[model samples]
Target: MAARRPVDDTTPHGTTPHGTGYGALLRTPHAWTFLLPALVARLPYAMLSLGIVLLVHDTTGSYGLAGAVAAAAAVSQALVGPQTGRLADRHGQAAVLVPTVVVHACAVAALIVLAHSGAPDWTLFLAAAPAGAAVPQVGAMVRARWVHRLAERPALLNTAFAFESVTDEFTFVIGPMLATGTATLVNPSAGLAAEAALTLLGGLAFAARRDTAPAPTGPAAPGVRRASALASPGVRLLAVAFLGLGTVFGTLQVSITAFAEDAGSGGLSGLVYGLFATGSMVAGVLYGLVPWRSSARRRMVVCYALLVLGCSTLWAMPNLAALTVAGLFCGLAIAPTLITGFTLVETLVAAGAKTEAFTWLTGSIGLGLALGSTAAGQLIDRSGAPLGFTVALAGSGLGLVALVTMRRLLLAPAPAHRTVARGGAVREEAAPAARRG
Candidate 1:
């Protein structure tokens, strides 16, 4: 008979390859209890985002201004992210989430009222700022909870993230469609208003769950408090990677719409995004189902190469179907890279700082997209979609360069003992023998 696998904290339950990891998260009762509410909370915000852009653009007849408003929200989210993450880390998710949800609800209502009242453009932007700021870091918080609830099995953790990523993709694709339908059938603002209500309900429902508490992964330490999760070399490199990739994605979103519109198929923008989402969704699931056999370093290198290739193809091709195919293939890298990066982050930080660390990761991606979108939009105004895609492809290539440069810091050999302080700073002290090995 085969030797029985060791049973310990890390593997409290036996590892059933076919039945384990991401598959278990969805199948388990406890996991779904938390997952359901998170999904609902995200759905409305997703809808609200698309609805606002379409509604504002329709009302103002200026896509540029509408784009500006959307970008402003991204800025607000980035600005408040660290603090919000810290709050969730120190106090708890409920402590941070409850109030954020309440404020977000009120802020959205205010934005709608202001927009309808012929509020000045600047005033409308101001109102939207609060809405953006008030939104909770639900996605990050949810992921953190998984770390606590499923601490023993890193594979399961990977699956949870995979599940979250796919859910987000689905929401973006379906939510926008819902908003578009509502806008056509009723009024554009109607969809946004519906989003506002749904956001409050969904965010609050998730917050109310007892299981959604923040997890403390490592020891707490003083230095961890001031250290931006971005300060960690691993995290910094990952952030740079995200920046490049997000720029490509952000520019592509804007440029694709322009491409379709110029071709007299304006509605194709939604279809294009849908294709991208489908690719990501399909890839996320596959990434989770496949076993992780290679070392982290090798895996990341391969994944990044795939991403670079996918992006490069987009730059070279102008055909809509071809672009979509390339995008789908390129999207395959996103979830795996993110999962690996976040796992590395988990190993690097103290327990107290996990929230901030992950928040910074998410924030970096947000910031990159905002900057990329702004720059790409400007470029499109001057040059056009082909040039925009070229710039995006180049940006992604640069990310690969950044990753290659940091190989030593990231691919360092594991230490024997890893200790985390209260503030979430980590120190690795290798045993003399382990170092010798």
Candidate 2:
């Protein structure tokens, strides 16, 4: 398969071709058409695990069980994610997403039914695996589209990635509120059902935009096997760092809920977590507007350092108010770190391997989430909520260490050209960072 070159005709007339501004990007033809559905499709990513925790605990009366079920889903997703990405890369996004969304929605619906039916505990656990596995990698696909659309404009690409990061934070904010509120106000089953409906609708809508999708790859040239993104030393280190960051997120979600339960305000857990996401959302928007002089690697390190400092402060908070404040402070670093890490991944791999590479990153986060939720749940069960904060602090510390120790690998220069396979022709262009000032 040969790389696809950028199409000069894609950009609409009267748009600034070289500008990194958001307005210019949004004004581009079919930009919002692609973004809106992708945003909707990813709402489940924020809701599913948290909804599972709430629903299972309400039915089974055990946070440990709830966490385990959620962890099961995360682990399943982690295992299956790359394979799904591979399929999307080799085939097409619609070919993979349409069927995957149907299975995922059905699985979620089944889980909801089982949860409400007083079924065996094992049944819910068994059902959650497929639900997670079927989750569409919306973020990666969207990023891939941006790579295709903005191939010639690195600055605009950075802005687009920043926008995507903000969208993720926004989804986290909205998803948890929707999930928890539905569970608390109506019924747990309703929350899951809503997730199912959204998954089906959004996934299909996103997939229907076939024009924006990347072209399917043909067979690799003889003696030129595609390199696994995980095999790259830099990507491996970055994945470990991402894993630790995922642990921080998973632990915080479960721990905050435990804290709310202890305070007799369990219904407020979503709001509290949403506030944390709100901080990151705001930061992501601002971060996108600025043109950074520092490299993505340096920016990532600084973000992690700030995150460590923020998480460390949670240890001293005496009440929910303090915890909320600490959470907001900690969130400031989250989006920046994620955006920089993803940008680094874009720089680290060939264009043909992007979806798989990004999925590997997502899988690392899932692995970390599974570990964090399981560990934090046990700690909260045995000790208390405050101890879970200690676990989060430790995870953040580990993430910082990983980034620091692997600084050299991360700082390596990005490839100078990327070969993209499109429509039986190969297109080569300057690497992502090559055009950056």
Candidate 2 lDDT tens digits, 321-359: 889988998999989888888877776666677788788
306-418: candidate 1 lDDT, tens digit per residue: 77777776756667777667767776776667666665566555556777877777766666656665666566667766666776777778888988877545532343444
Task: Give the local distance difference test score of model 2.
Answer: 0.83
Clashes of each: 10, 6
User: Which candidate tops lDDT?
Assistant: 2
Residue 363 CA displacement from its true place in model 2, Å: 1.8
> Which residue pairs overlap in candidate 1's backbone?
218-351, 219-420, 219-421, 220-421, 220-422, 220-423, 221-421, 221-422, 221-423, 350-424
| Candidate 2 C-alpha RMSD relative to the actual structure | 6.6
- The lowest-lDDT stretch of 10 consecutive residues in candidate 1 is 4-13
